[model samples]
Structure formats: C-alpha cells, structure tokens
Target chain A: MHKDRLVAVAFTLWAVLVTGAFLQANGAYLFGKLLERLGR
Target chain B: MLAFAVTAALILALAGLGRPLAWRLGTCRNGQHLTEAELWALAPLLGALPLAVLVQVVGAWRYDPLSMAVTLAVALLPALAFLRLRPFVPVLPWWPWGWMLAVLVGLMAVSALAPPLDHDSIRYHLTLPRRDLELGRIGLWFGWSIYEFFPPLTALLTRLAYALGGAAAAQMLNVFWVVMAALWAGLLARRLGLGPQGAMAAALLFVSQRVVLNLGAAVTTDIPLAAFIGAFAAVAVAGTEGARRALLLGLLLGAAMATKYQGIVAAVAMMTPLAVLALLRRRGLPALILAGSVALLVLSPILLRNFWITGNPVFPTAHPLFGADNLDIFAPFTQAMAARSVVPGGLAALPWTMFILQDAFDGLQFGFPILLLGLPFAFFRHQGGRALCLVGIVIYTLVWWGAMPHLLRFLQPIFVPLAALAAAGLVEVAVVGRRIGWFRPVFAASVGVAIGIQALFAGSSALYRLPVALGLADIRSALEVPAFQYYGLITPCLWLQDNLRPGERYVAVINDPSVYCPQAPTLHPLGAGEAARFYSRGGLPALSAAQVAEMLRGGNVRYVLVANNPGTDDETYAFAKHRFDAVLLPILRQQKPLVDSASGKIYDALAVLAALESGIGAAEPASGR
Candidate 1:
C-alpha cells in the first residue's frame, strides 16, 4: 500500500511485460534453430 | 587460432601503448590516481585513436604488409618503455567474471572461425581495405560506392588486421572493439558512483544486448564507433578539469568521428552542454578550444581526403552546400532510403516503436526491454553523475532521432551511457526496496528472468557457429552449409576467386560482396541502379544492346556476377526490375554462365557483350525493313 511498494510493483510488471514480449518475439526462432541443429 | 593470436597480440600492444597516456590524462584534478579498473578500461581506448591515425598515414603512402609491419613495430617500440606498468587484472566477483568469460568465448569463437561476411563489411568495411591493400595506397575508389567517402578510420584499422592475418583476423579485431565498449560501460557506471556489482551489471547488460552480440565480431565500424563514444562519455563524466583531460576528450571524440559520420552527432551532443556550461562559468574556454582543435587534428585526414576528391569535406552529406556531382550514382538508393522514411509512428512513438517493433527500423532487434524498464529508476537515486549521463543520453537520442536514419545500430553508442543509468537504477531500486517486504524478491526474480532470456538468445546465436570455431568443421564447409547462407556470397565469391585469371576484371551486380572476390570486381552499388544510371545513361531500356556492350567494353569488364534473387521488396530488386531487366538481362541470358547455382550466376562479360554486338549487327538489316 506504500508508495515505494507501488512503484516497485509497477516496475516489476513492466519488467515482466518486456521479458514476455522479447521471449514471444524471438523464443520460437531460437528454439527452432536449436532443435534443427540438434537434429542435424 | 592464428587469427585469434594476432588479434590478442594487437589488443595487448594497443593497451601497452595507451597505458601511460591514459594514466596521465585520467589522474583526477585533485591528484588522485585512477583505479586499476579505470586505467585498464581507458588504456585501449586511448591507444586505438593514435594507431588508427598512424595506419591512415601509412596507408596513404602505401598499405603493403611490410609497411604495416614496420609502422606497428615503430609504434610498439615506444610502448615498450612503459613495460613497468603492470598487466591489468580485473577484480570482479565470480558471477560477473563467469558472464564475461562466456560472452568473450562466444564472440571470439564466432570472430576467429569466420571470414568477414556480414553485409556492410563485405560491401565496404572489408572491401575498401582489401582494395587499398591491392592498390598499395589508400586512394579514393569513387567507382565502388558512396561509402568510400565515409570516414575510413575503422577500415584502416581493419586493413592492418587484414594485412597481418587475413579477413578472419580483421573480424577478430572487431571483437576487441566490442570488449572495449563493454569495459567503457563498466567504467562509466563506476564514475556514476555505482558499486562493483552495479558496474559489472552495466557491462554485462551492454555485451548481452542482441545488437552487440549480432555485430560484435563482424568487421564493421559500429562497434568500434560505440567504443570511442563510450570512452568519451566516461572521460567527460570524470569531472577532471585540465588540459590533459580536454585533450583526451578531444582525441576520443575525433576517433569516434573518424569511425563514423554519426560521431558528428555524438560530438555535438557531448560538447554542446560542456561548451555552454564552460561559457556560463567563464572558465574552461581555453581547454575546450584545445580539445576542439585536437579533435579536428585527429579528424583532418578524412576531411582533407574528402575535400580533395569530392570538393566536399563531408561528402555524401552536405551535398547541397558543395553541389558536388560525385554522389549522383547514389541518388536512386538515397532516394529509396528517403522514401522509406523509416520512423514509424512518428517521433512521438519512437520510444515505443524502437523497443517493440525494432524489426521495422532495420530488421535487427536491438536493445533490451530491461534498459527501458530500468531507465526511470536512476532518477530516484540523485546520484553524482546520473544527471550528466541522463543529459548525454537524451541529447544523443534526440539528435539521432531527428537527423540520422532510424536504424537501431546507429543508436548503439547511446547504449553505453543508457546501460550505466539502467544498472544504477536497478541497483538503487534494490537497495531502496530492502525496506519494503516482498519487493526485493519480486524485483530480483523479474530482473533475473529478463537477463536469463537475453543470455539464452545470445548463447543460442553463438552456439550455431561453435563447430567451425572448434575446428570440428572447416570454415569452407560451414560457408556452404545452407543454415549459414547469411555469411554472404562466400561460395560464389570463392568460385570467382578460383576461376578468374590475374588481370581479369569482373562486374558484381545486384548484391556486391566483392570483399570475398580477390580478382578486383567492379561493384554496382546496391544492384543495377548505379549501373543503369552510369553505364546505360538515359536508362537501360533507352540504350540498345550495342550501346550496352560498348559501355562494358569501355570499362574493360570481363565477367558479370549477378544474384538471381536480391529480395524483391528491397531497393536492389526494385531498381534492377525497373531499369536492369529492360536491357542488361536479355543480353546476359544469351551467354552460358561460367558458374550457376541457387546463390547467383557468374557470366563471362566479354562473351556476353561479344554475342550482343554480333547479334545487333546481324539484326541491323532485318530492322531496315
């Protein structure tokens, strides 16, 4: 309920959003390449 | 392995040469010596500019291996006097060291195993230097591309690397720049009064960025430019008010300018505030003047060369001021770039779009979201140099947004200062959050997750090239692998190198990767646009087969290398389809190519032209009807 806690919560949410977006964008391609290489 | 050894030797030599100079300049105004970390970080940064200038001087005379060796020996001989200065031993915690080791190994593997094959490197970075080595002098090859007029500092440095240990060596040399940039980031964080952990975090954040990982090992100017810009920021933020500091700042700025044109923007961003502050205080004016003059001295070679060749000190830019006609060849490509106007969602949306839709800018996903997330938290701490770092980032980004192309890589230099701020913010937030229950754990977990994802991406990218790096497979074999086709026109270029006789000239069309072709290929800058504009004159469609053949003969071009698929949506294909297909393709189709594959076709230009001339003569009487 404190302002500092609220700030921390907001930052945490932003970090999660960013991390999710990055993974969503690049995770599939990276994993696919790894799989392809492993198969090879 | 030889390439790696040569690159390492070069880096140590540079560090040795720079140590005393950095020591002199980095000592605080109050007579305090630099920390070991700061000195080691500053040494290579100080050393590289002078060596780059030395290479330019030697290159201007002649860029032979013997001359380069002699120049290097002369430079190293003086540095030997500073042997008493001990070797740098980084005193970092285990985790940071682990991350650094991983990144370094991955980067070195990629750089040491591969020849320079990235698009920009092949196009000009390595190609220009290769041409200089061939010609035995660093004269302007105006016929190649407009990029020839750009600052040749990094190219000159690459030339030394190329002369010593070949293309792989030059690539390995670029990895040094990446390391230097990361080191400067850490040093900047330290100057901002961050603890050792925060400094290491800043360095790791910078090195782990996808953009850095992607281009870190490539023989390109961006990484080196970033290093110089970062070094300048670190020095500027030290609050050392003396002539030596000013000189150091000037040299770094000059080196950055010589590395890339965007350095001009960086210089303006850094100096504008300092100049204004100094003017208000009525002190430091003389120091500023000394710094400005020294920077100009460092940059004068490129400016003079451009002025001599194009009548524009900064050619390709300020064309309107000079009214120079040399850039006419670049008009179509330049116009196409202008039409793209790459800033999507306008200036207001740049912050959102730059991070979210990074692909829209240049197809390279650059910068981490953690950087954006951590940026605001730096303001909460009210740290010593936070205000300065924030101002530099803001000014640099604003200028880049307005004046420069919206490519993510151009904004790379700003990442050094931004990473410092971000690291400071994260560290500060964690320190503050310890008072609140549950905040520290949640924050730590989120930060860890973000960094872990980035590391995974970086590691995966590096892992793909590990086989060639570990010598399990030959580099040639790796080049032929379909999965590694983005290594540019290696197969076709090697085929040309093997086939083309000495003294025979080839013309590379559509995609020019002539750095790989040793037989002196004439490059049509970005496909057939410049070729259509120059050789065909009015248009390829307007010119007859005889005229085209005559033009080819006039240029003494014997072979034609054409990429069949140059990506239709890009400007290369658009220009080729509009102008090249009209006249050149039909003539080229008449001849059986010397080499043909999925990559492209290589034709005997003389044969193609000969057939065209004879066919035109044969059809003249029939056309009389």
Candidate 2:
C-alpha cells in the first residue's frame, strides 16, 4: 500500500511481463509454440 | 607510439583542465562529488571530442602525427600544471582486483594488435576516416554510405589512430574506451551506494555481456557511446544539483552526442529526473537550461557540420522537411530489418521473445538474464536509486521496442544503467542478509558466487583472445573473419593487400569493407538501397556488368574484391540484395583471380571487367527496335 511498494510493483510487472513474453517467442518454448506465437 | 603517448598525456591533461571547468560550473553540491574513476573515465571524451572537432574544422583530417604532437604538446602545459596542483586521495573500496585475473588489460593490448574485423569497422567506421587521411582533410567521401553523416566523436578518435599507425591502430583506440566504460560502470555502482565488491561485480557484468566483450577489439560506434553515456549517467546519478554539476552533466552528454545520435535521447532521459527533483525544490529551469546549454556546447559543431554538408539538419530522416529528393538511405535499411523488431503480437509478447525465443545470436543476444533477474531489486527499495535507474530503463526499453527492436547493439546504453541497478540490487540483498543472522552466510555466498561467475565470463573471453589480440598468435588468420560472417571472404583481401602494389586503389564489390582501409585507397560501391533495389529484384537495369566496370576504371580502381554475398550471406530472404555485387560475381567466375579466399576472388579490375574494348554495353532502347 506504500507508494514505494506500488512503484516497485508497477516496474516489476512491466519488466517481467514483457520480458517473459519475449522469452517464450525467442526459442524458450517448443519450436511449434514459437512458430504459433510468431504467427499470432 | 609517440603519437599515442602524446594522446594519452593529452587526455589526462584534458581531464585536468575539465576539473576546473567543472568547478567553475559549480553545479553539483551536497553529496555530488565525482569518484576518481568516474572523473578519469569521462575526461578523455570530454577532451578529445572538442579537440578532434577543432582539428576537423581546420580541414585537417590528414591526422598527421606532427599536427597531433604539436597540438597535444601545447595541451600538456595546463594538464601537467593541473595534475601537480591537485593531489587527491582515492576513495574506492579495493574489490576489483579481478580485472587482472580476467587479463582485462591484456585483452585490450591484444585486440588492439589484432586487425579490426567487425562489419561496421571495415565498411565505413574505418573507411570514411581512412579516405579523409588520404585526401588530407575531413569531408564526406562515402556518399552512398549514410553512416558518414552520423556524429563523428568516435570516428574522430579513429582518425587520430589512423593518422598515427593506420587502420589497426585507429581501431586499437577502442581498447581505451573499453576500459573507461568498465571503470565507469563499477564507479557508478559505488555512487548508487553499492559496496566496492558490488561495484566490481557491476563492472564485471558489464564486461561479460558478449556484445560488450566482443565490441572492445572491434571498432564500432557502440563501445565509445557506451563509455560516454555511462559516464554521463554516472555523473547524473551521483552528483547533486549545482552549476558545476550541471556543467559536468552537459559536458558528458555533449560528448555522448558527439559519439552517436542516441546521446540526444539519453541526454533527455538523464535530465528529466533531475529537472523534476529540482522543480520539486521550486527551482528547476535554471538547472535544466544550464545542462541543456552545456550539452549543446559539445554537440552543436557536429550538427553545424551536418547542416552544412547535407542541407537537412538530421539528414535523410527529414527529407520531406529539407525537400531533398531521395536523401533517405538509412531509413530504408532500418525498415528492411523491421520485421525482426516486432514481437509478433507486438508489446504483448516482447518480454518472452526478446529473451528466450529470439535466436541467441540475434538482437538482445544477452537478452534479459542479468538485466531482468535483478529487476525486482532495482525497483523494490532504495527508492531514490531505484527510481533513477528504473525510469531510464523503462523509457529506453519502450522506445527501443517501438522503433528499432531488431537491432541489438543499440541497447548498450540502456543496459549500462540496468546492469548498475542490478548490481545495486544484489548489494542491497547482501546488506540486508547480514542483519538477518541465519540467512547471512547464504546470501553472502550467493553474491560472491554471482560476481565470480561474471568475472570468469569476462576473464575467459579476454584470456582466450589475449594471444591473438596481442599479436602473439597468427593475426593474419584471425583478421580473416569477414565483418559480415555470411558474406565476405578474408583470404582474398589478405592476398590483395599482401600482393598489390602500395598506393593502389581497391574497389570492394561486396558487403565487407574492413580489409580495404588498411591495404589501399578504397571505395564501397553501393549503398544499402542500391544493393537491395538492384540485387533483390534479381536484375540490374539492362546495363551490362562491364559498363559498370568501365565506371570503376574511370574512378581509378586498380582491383576489385568480388564475392557472391547475396542469397548466400543473410537469412532475411524476402528478397535478394546484392545486385551490384552479384553483377561482379559472373565477372569473377570468368577469371583466373589474382588470388582467392574461401568465399571471394580478387581480380585486377583492368583485366577482369575489361580487356581493351568490351564493357557492359548500354541496354538497347525499345525505340531502336
């Protein structure tokens, strides 16, 4: 609930969410998944 | 060697001179003192860029040793006097001994000795400056290559190197900037309140990133830009508000801008946070204006030069504004690689794709490991430090994703701050664990282990290449790696340099340009668009190949370095893009090459493209029919 904690949450979500999605498409998952993600 | 020594002295002297300039600005105060390392890291760029521009303004791109020696000899006066006057104690915690173990110093020495083999180095990084040295003045000789117009801060240093010892020496200057960047990284960590060990870890992590490791020996605008931007960020983060602090900020930002256009974006990113803090204190505009003015002081010369030469202020981009027809080469080349940038579903998928899904060798090659794993630490606590670094990373990352995600090295500037923040994160954890009794040893060990791993990664790269970089190994074989691995062949270029007469001019009919500068007068034949339009389309305008060769002869080309480099070298094959070069392939196949490499052939331009009479005849007109 503190302002600092809120700031931390916002930043962490941005880095991890965007970074996590990119990780999967970049060859993290199976080739099929990568292809599927790429197609979408 | 004398020129190099003089240049070193000149850099130190400039640092000495900059101290006063910084003092006079009186911008930073109340906990804004610069570390010894930070000051040293930033000093050379501060000194060299302005002096290099001065030399250029006088139309002296000849880079003659005497000119440099005399100029620097005068510069040494104040520098020595200043050094003698200011004997200060170092405040660093002694934890970065790992630099020696990594043979970091040795890597710099060796790579400097090894020939420059990076793609950009050969193509235009070296070639543009090399041509100017030949002509004895600074001017845009490579009209087809748009890289000529980008800021020349790094290239100015390259000019000095070329003037001193030729291409290899020019490129070797990167070794200096590499060390500067690492030192800045570690010191920046220290400023963020990380311990000496954490600072060292930060520096080690910075060096461990494969691109950073590789780029030191290879000349590109990236490494120097990293050093300058890192230096700028260091000053911005550690120093408090004052006239002097603002001036130092301006100087570093200007130096960064002088190195690459990214400096402008980075300057804005760096200033926004500080300006806000000042505004919160109810006095922001003066600081902002001072910082902006100092940055412009360093940056304006390059812009003036561009405006004079290109008519458009930011050349090729604002072609519509300038109303210059078709001065747009860089934009198209960038657009060609656009698909690789998009995260399929776009921002929604960027995180996963940039890190794990993308090819290991492609953009963001070191993706988000050290950077992302430590993200929570960056954001969690130390609100002041966390916010400073986070704002930069988020802004640059979003911008990078939106516009130019496919190109990886551009991420270097952003990564420096991120890496520092990551180091800060670990340091925080290490500090907290000590107070927690039972968890103390485990946390300490983890921190040590992580730092050790990064140091090992950094060390092994330097040690592996130590011999080659130092010229202990067969440098000739090492230099043979084409700047563009898929396209160029090195042996034929070596053969041309070894066998061709001195002072001869070479027309390289392929993608790589590294070899041409060291050997002879050089010309890269076509721009990126010209290549794509001609080769990817599968044919040249019915103009015969020999006619183009005739054009070369008139331009005084003695030999042509010809390689296939088309569908053979790159993967993005929506189209073929080596038309002018491919046109040379048939001509090469028909000849007994003067010599050959694994992937290329070298032929006497006079003999291969023409015997006496025949050349590519102009296409017959339909009207003739």
Candidate 3:
C-alpha cells in the first residue's frame, strides 16, 4: 500500500512537470492567437 | 442543406454496408468472434475501404455513377448478406461515449455540410478522382497527375463520394474515417483492459486532440491510417498465434500502406512484435513470410504499376538503379527531405517540442497535454492481453523519432495506442484517488480541466464552419483561418467551369489546379518534381516552352493555369515556384490568356497544338515517359 502510494505520488509529480511544460509551451501559441483576436 | 443531407445518407449507407463486411472478413476463424460495436470499429479498413478502393481501381478505365454504383453494389451486397452472421456487442458507456459521439457527429456534420476545402483534397484526394472521372478511367499511366504514382486508397473513396453527390460526399468519407478512428480508440483502450470509462477516455483523447478535430473535417489519409494502426493493435492484443493473426495483421498493415506511405512506418512498428512472437513460438519464418507476402501482394499492384511506368517501384527514388539521368533534380529534393530541421534538443526535448510547442513547421502539432499527463499511468502495471501494446507505442515513437520526429501527421498513426495508454493513465489516477483521500479531488479537478481545455480548443475550431452544416449558409465564407483562404481561389475554377471552351483543358501552375478548375480536366503538373527529375538527369537539354508544352500535350495536357502565387495546397516541392519560370517562361509571355485574372494566368494550349501543326514540336518528355 505504501509503495503504491509512493508510485502514485511520483506519478503526480511527474505529471505536474509535464502538464506545466505543455500548458506553458502550448500557451505561447494560444497567447499569440488571443492577442491577435484582441488586436482584431 | 438537401445536398448535405442526401450525401450524408449515401455515405452512411455505404459505411453501414462496410461494417458487416469488415466483420465477416476480419473474424472468420475458429473461436473468433466480435461484437457489432467492435465490427463497426474495425470494418472501415478491413471490409469496406478495400472494397471502395477496389471499385475505383477496377472501374478506373470506365468510371461514372452508373458504373461505380454497380461496382459498389456488387461489393456491398455480399457484405450485407453477412450482417446477420456476426455476434453483437454494445458500445462502452457514457462520459466518453457521449462526448465522443457529439464530437464525431459535430465533425461529420461540419465536414459533410461544408464543401471539401482541404488543400490536399482539393489538389488530389478529390482532384485525382475528379480528373479520372473526367478521363473516364483510373488512367494513371498517361495523366501526369503526380498523385497517381502514389497510393489511390484515399483518392478512390473520395472519388466515389465525389461521383455520387459532390465534394460534400467525398468529405463525408473523411468524416466516416475519423469516426472509425474514434471507435478503434475505444476498442484499443478496452483491449488494454481499461474499464468502460477508460475506454471512453481513450477515444475522447483521440477526438479531443486539436489536430484530429481540425483534420477530422479535412480529407486526408493520416487519420484513416491512424485508425488502421489501432485496428492492428486490437488484433495484436487478441492473443492469436500462427497464420490467422499474421494474415489479419498483414491485411491491416497492407491497408495502412495503401492509404499512405507512412503505413511503412506502421508496418515496421507492428511487424517487430509479430517477428518476436513468431520467434518465441518457433513459427518465425513462415509467419514472417505470410505477413510479408500479404503486404507485398496488397502493395504489388501499385508497385508494379509504378515499375511498369517509371521503371522504379517507388518512382523518382531509385534514380541510380533506373539510370542516374535525373540527379540534379532529385538530389536536392532528397537532401531537403532528409534535412528536416531537427527539433532542437533532439529526443530529450521531443516531449516538450511535440506536446507544448503548437507552432512547429506549418502550425502542426497533436500531442495533447492530457495525453502526456495520463501516459505515465499506462506503465504502472502490465496491461491486459498477451501482446504488449506499450511495446508497439515505444517502437512507433522510436521510429518516428528516428526517421521523422517533427512531422506530426506522419507520426499520427501512433495516436491510436498513445490515446489508449493515456486513458489507462487516467484510470490509474482514479486508482490512486481511491487510495489517497485528498488525491481524489485533485484527479477529478485535473480530469475536469483537461476535458474542458481540450473541448474548448478542439470543439471551437471544429465548429467554425458549423453554420454551413446547419443549412444556414450557402458557400463557405466563415471557415477558420487557413481554410478561409481557399474560398477566393475556388472562384477562378468556378469561373473556368462556366467560361471554358469545350475540350479545352488546363494545367494548374497554381498550388492546387484541381480545386481551382474542377469544371475541366486541370493538372497541377508538379512542375518542381518534373523540373527536379528533368534537370537531375544531366543529359536532358533545356526544353523550350513549345517543347515542354508539346511534351505535356502527349498526355492530353493542353492549357496551363500559372498562378500568381502558390495556391493553398501544402508545399509538395520547395522549388515549385521556379517550375513555370524555368520551363515555360515564353509560353507565359507568348500564349494569349484564355482567362487571365488575379488568381493566375490560364494560357491556351493551342500554342502547343499550333507548334505541333507547324512541326516545331521538340523532343519528347524523358521523365514520366
């Protein structure tokens, strides 16, 4: 049970890094578009 | 509205017939059974798609609604007879199902409702068949359709659709394939022993990807090929050994290969597993041979056709074997293709580059963040089935990273397994939630946020042309960014259709000659490819405008529509802009405009006819000759 908990915690942490990077990377494009829309 | 409705009915009927047929062909063995839902999922490629491509091929020399309809009926009737023999199963439950269905129908209705505006579809998928329909045959040898040398799987079906109703009918084929891909996603997740929710999540991830949503409505073979990859994965997970599994896997692989060249990537990915399995069971040699034989047989006709015409099975690739006359033309192209801008930081940065950086070359990227989020969970434990789905994903990803890392569409086939694994991750999150109290809401919040974000991006973009689908508009004026650019270009084609002289043909120097000039037989001529191959072989002399036009005229290529700029099609060759300038500069100046506008110059081919009549027709074409 403890090991499963540990694995889950590791997974959550890993996911956080990936999700953060993805959102940040994806946001560059999204932000550009939002700005374009705003400017329009 | 009526056009959309009628075309929808026609494609649904065709796809309906295909489902039963696919079930009959794919599961015909001892102890082999599949539910209706499963059959529906797999049938598009296994049963119906082959039939569709075959109908177009056999009826190539003489294709029309009457002939094609008869051919389709011949294929569908037999499959319809097998419908009652298959076992039935229901679709997995809601959340995913409801979301998937909504997204699928939304995409279908949008794609079907709008005219086919995908630049590639306009250029070839719809264009090749439209040209063949004009020529009254499959007519690959003569017509320098550039696309004809490649596989005809996507074109043939779209051609059938074009013949039946119009562009809308052909667009529905893409829609049906997208839906099939979604179904396969569910089945692949289920095969991985994910629960119904997990299955739904898998499928949802597939449809949710912004690229899939954008591409779902657009006619392309990437998604269809991806669907086949999923089908192949599901078959691999079936725990079968020996000839049956090999045959099924081969069939799926062949279907993938037929759809796009990327199928070779998929073929290798799936073949590795089969090879390992065969070795373990001591059936390695025979199994490999069977699989190889089937794929070769499927591809043989195309290869043979290519060999027959160009003396090369793949065409333009084996310049040395076939005589290295075209080195200059092909060398740079080969180098340019091989020299893809390495995603900076190589494989380590691939995750961020693929998933995060949305604006890679040509605004193409498909790795949804949720997929990344959920992927780790798929590896938490051994998935269901004797076959390792993870191995297939790893193989496919490695191959993608090795060969073509940056190009998303080429790597799209891996999406099937990737989406399923992501779903498994989500399910794992739920498992973790069950263990840890506070983690439960975190998982739920993540799910809610992930789904919300994906839906917002994918759904909004997909619905851009929904008004056209809803019968509220006439022509596509409100298309999203890239597609909207195509609206003005179709005007010249429409104008040409109305104004052109009978038996007067055209060659589109513009990017997509097919879309612009659908009324008459128009050819893009792929001047860059022609020039490259022509100039590559050193002996080929600088052919004059008269000489070039005369050479093209041998295949009944007459008038050429030289675009002011490259029209809306994806860039096939880097030096495409130089084709007309280098080869036919004088024709642009000397030939009188049949209908010269801002779109491009439509030069009369009668000059070539005149040159021939005057006996100035120079040396024949050395390339596609």
Tell me how far the alpha carbon of residue B475 in candidate 1 is from the true structure, in angstroms, after superposition. Answer: 5.3
Off by over 4 Å in 1: A1-7, A20-40, B28-33, B96-101, B104-106, B279-283, B324-345, B471-487, B519-544, B547-558, B566-583, B622-625
lDDT of 3 by residue, B114-211 (tens): 76655566656766677667777767632244456776666666666677667776776677777778778888888787877777777878877777
True contacts kept of 1: 0.50
Estimate candidate 3's alpha-carbon lDDT, on a 0 to 1 scale.
Answer: 0.64
The TM-score measured for candidate 3 stands at 0.83
Backbone N/Cα/C clashes per model = 1, 39, 13
lDDT of 2: 0.60
Could you give the candidate ranking by DockQ, starting with the highest? 3, 1, 2
Clashing pairs in 1: B510-B527
Error of 3 at B31 (Å): 5.9
What do the candidate models score in CA lDDT, each in turn?
A: 0.71, 0.60, 0.64
* lDDT tens digits by residue: candidate 1, B1-625: 7677767767776877787788887775665456777777778777877787788788889888899888777767656755775565776764853466465546655645665535676666777778777788876654355677888777777888888878888888888887788778888888888878888888877877777777776777878888887878777777536778887888889888988888888887877777777898898878887888888988898899888765678876755466522324444555666576566678788776677666567654554577877878888766647787777777988987766656677788788888888888888777767877778788878777766667665765566456666667665665555633533556677788787776666665554454776634452333333432432224334556676666678767777777664333232322223233345677776778888765567788878777777888899999998
How would you encode candidate 2's per-residue C-alpha lDDT over A1-40 as one tens digit per residue? 3443444344445445544554355433334543653463
Error of 2 at A10 (Å): 16
In angstroms, the error of model 3 at B332 is: 5.6
Against the correct fold, how does model 2 do in TM-score? Answer: 0.80
Interface RMSD for candidate number 3? 2.1
